[model samples]
Target: MTATILLTPAVEERAPCTLPPRLVLAPGETTPVLIDGAWWPRSRDLTAELPALIEILDPLWGRITRVTVNPTFWPVIPRKVPVRGHVVHVGWFEAEQDPHKLLLLSYTVGRWDLLVIPPETEPAIAARLMATATDPSRSLTATGLIHEAERFRITAEEAVGSDSLREAVWDSEGGNDARRPASHASAGAVIDHVPSPAEGR
Candidate 1:
């Protein structure tokens, strides 16, 4: 199935916030927000909290064609491949009217995917499907968790190396120096305690 993946920067709980005024639920209008790629609460009170979240995530949602909430994942039993993959399911809702869709929130895992539905009612249906999602935590044995943690460490190291290379290239291309500025006098200073050959003789 076709899906769009959106990556959000790490969420900081202490960051400032802003949101829109809560909307009265119309007969056919619905909004939902996904928290860590999962459906979050979508009551009138919860929707009212969207404005503050919207402020923090203003940069991210600007490019989004639409926002969705109550995302679900279904594990695909591999037929030919030995590994299983998860399919993302989502409910589409109007970002403006749905406070759930506008909240700037963070996830434990650093990434989230929003599935924009062409039809608004799709989200409500997706929410039901999401209720059946298998808890990823439950699937991971202790050993699996350990292995995954180790893999993450290795990935982080590789990322650091990649960043260093990029920085070096940028510096070569006259990019801003990341190092602290050095004083001219300090750079030019020299030691002067030499003796002539004749004096030594």
Candidate 2:
């Protein structure tokens, strides 16, 4: 969609701030970023590497507030009843990239969304996030790159089942339930005997 940038007070005061970076969308408008560079594909590897990535980027930027990775359901209609399926593992990092503004790095599985918001731009944050997910590279900065690594981790984790679910499944199979039998028949046998939708009538 449209390019969006958010600048917090910390970033707004900085001289490095340029024309707010446009969210890269069109085929020919993409920024040249090395996606496969430095960062690992696995979440664990990325998590392990985050500290270093932040350290390397911090001096170039300003101060990093926090890096957060969580599942988020972005509602197309804010007040709608039946919201759509969620876009999982929407990763974010809030950093003071400049003295007068805040740099927000928002990313998901497909793309990165960057925003440079002035201290007073809090209300427009959601719109800015949506824009960043469309294209993250246009806002490429030292802080943004650090966040990309974490976003990659979040994406990788979403691909697999959650630890809690995995543990429950594993524990059930390893415990007494592992020996339990079906009340009727095995799944394969049940499938073989299933009636067609038409036959049920």
Candidate 3:
């Protein structure tokens, strides 16, 4: 197994807001697959984004005691985040962690891996990705699924100017082609181990 460096920075605990996260899970029971679902967070702020996710997932999959993510996509990697009444430890592995995936550990459900879709992705593209990631027949890893999605993407021309101008142009281009964006596929790593309570905490 690849070694992971755990970081436990002292972070202030706050109440979970219980907001909904853009997530889609594979139908049926969990099975052996590279990715079990996909999550498209609104932003790269881990501290702000995680509580809502934890609130939605805990009751269904059991209390998530630990969450591991790659630091590449997230700007702020907190040591721990509060959800409900408990704390969830967060960790990161530079080398072996997939930048496009998030690994969650729950004592009841075991380990779960999810594809981390880019926040700026268009809604149409993101919806397709969510469907692909949760398809039980598709066993692609987070990276694999992204590459597959890129194959069908049609990049829209860049609108050079103010943000308002960009939005105006985006609104005017009302066609099927307008819904796509440039490919965001990138290289990522794989993680296979779930740390025991004694070692993870």
* Most lDDT-accurate candidate: 3
Worst 10 residues of 2 by lDDT: 74-83
Q: Least lDDT summed over 10 consecutive residues: which range in candidate 1?
A: 75-84
Clashes of 3: 0
**TM-score against truth, every candidate:** 0.21, 0.20, 0.68
Q: RMSD in angstroms, all models?
A: 22.0, 17.8, 16.8
TM-score, predicted candidate 3 vs. hidden true structure = 0.68
lDDT of 2 by residue, 41-123 (tens): 11222123234433433343333334332112111111111101211121332231221112223232232222222222323
Clashing pairs in 3: none
Kindly list the per-residue Cα lDDT of model 1 for residues 28-53, writing each as its tens digit: 12232232222332322222333333
**Model 1 TM-score on a 0 to 1 scale:** 0.21
On the 0 to 100 scale, the lDDT of residue 2 in model 1 is 26
